[model samples]
Target chain A: MTEKEIQVREKQEVQQAGEPTKPERYFVPPVDIYETDEDVTVLADMPGVAKDGVEVRLEDDTLTIKGTKGGNGGEGERVLLREFESGHYLRRFTIAEIIDQAKIEATMVDGVLTLKLPKVEPAKPRKIVVQGG
Target chain B: MAIIRFTDRPLFRNPWADFERMRREFDALFQGLTGEYPRQVGGTVYPALNISEDADHLYVRAEIPGVKAADLDISVEGDTLTISGERATGPAEQRFSYHRREIECGRFSRAITLPTRVNPDQVGAGFVNGVLTIILPKAETAKPRKIEIKTQ
Candidate 1:
């Protein structure tokens, strides 16, 4: 079979799985990506998500975020005017080679997710010394 | 008059009648003191607020843990500032039968009056770590100026 035929077969299998043919729904939080001298910082807004509920994983070259938000329950008649429904959130990003995967650190505070991705040693700046004869 | 004659008199009277009347009266008094009645008795609670000040600016930080940037509305009129937002609740039909809920959710609005005049054009707002930081810079005239000292 040709390469195109193999690609078509894979697409058919994915469609049959009853899953979204396109990428998963992006729970793109309002993320601020900033870089300092030592590392790059990623600040993500993941409200109602506890520290224990958040899951950050890196596989191959992809980084993924997954979490669940618990519902609110009370023993009274509720007249809800507006609702912000929460569900399992998933987001993945393809990482670049400049990232030092081993040195990555993640912390969750007040439902915000902060990831610090340090650049590789070779990617960091270094000063050269001059010698006068 | 319609009941001019005593037809039948009960041998015993309901003693709890007086107690029930007292309970109702107490409830009414409590409601009156609170302004709004029962329906408004229990609602969403507001989070704690922290404010800091420096020579250049005043920083107001609110602990709004579950609100998103898109859901938030911030407005400043003169010296009055308001921040309002709604938090995301979980999915429909995904109900929790019994669980301890500590985090606050629902619509919240907070207003603050500034101590000094602020430069509205230079005001900055940022949300990080589930805390909203609003920076209000002092007006040029309100800011402290360094006076030149002449050697006599």
Candidate 2:
């Protein structure tokens, strides 16, 4: 998939990392979070961000999702109207359960980011069976 | 006399831009006393766009997240161009209930009249990252013609 494609290109841009002189506009991407039988799923709309432009990080109990979308609008194109602002996507959420961080998986399709965070099995309720009395 | 006015506009204008303007005025004039709840008029909820034109083509770019080319329908009739599409809500088989919901999802439609005639067949569109771009080339006859000077 294109997911790996982004990682390969990411290697080239690593040396140039850090804050730039001009600060960019950062906006929160809308998200829908749900908890299933064994996992929690997060779906966020982060249009314009490519696979390489997205970042998901977990530290302590906080989970952060960041995405950057590069736009090369045809030069000299005058804007006749404006509706939405184009910028970076940044969002953070605190986890309530002990999540299996190693088991987390994320995918970017079109402009949507689908994240699966599996809960630690030990955290789920388990029933013990009694032998013959 | 034609006078140009400028101000902050809503997110999206309805198909009828003229009426959307009128509705905004009415919404302001009537204030909040009406029986129904007051709401901003003709504002787009997600992915705003911009339209621009040069001599050859009209350029349009919309910031739509997760919009697939197949999920969109674009057409041009007369001077108006329309774009409509749906944003999929992701896998439908999640058995768990939604803990929190904030992103808006549904079919969206918007149409705008161009400033000049364009050749529909020559139009080109591209979707990158999540932005949708459309280049509508001007019609052959509509393009300005330059007359060459004759030598003395």
lDDT tens digits, residues A17-120, model 2?
Answer: 24344545466777889998799999887878999999999999999998987865656654456544456778889989789999999999878899999988
Instruction: Pull out the clashing pairs in model 1.
Output: none
Model 1 misplaced stretches (Cα beyond 4 Å): A1-133, B1-45, B93-96
Best by TM-score: 2
Against the true structure, whose lDDT is highest? Answer: 2
How big is the positional error of residue B145 in model 1, measured in Å on the Cα after superposition? Answer: 1.5
DockQ, in order, for the candidates?
Answer: 0.04, 0.27
Tens-place lDDT digits, model 1, residues B11-128:
6868886896687568657854663222222223243344556777877655465467778888888888787777764334233221223233456666667777888888899875
RMSD of each: 25.3, 15.0
Clashing pairs in 2: A47-B65, A48-B130, A84-B48, B11-B44, B12-B44
Second chain only: TM-score per model? 0.63, 0.62
lDDT of 2 by residue, B39-85 (tens): 33343433345677777888887766666889988899877988888
CA-lDDT, candidates in order: 0.57, 0.72
Docking class of 1: incorrect
* Ten contiguous residues with the weakest lDDT in model 2 chain B: B34-43
Candidate 1 C-alpha error for residue B121, in Å: 1.3
Native contacts recovered, each model: 0.08, 0.62
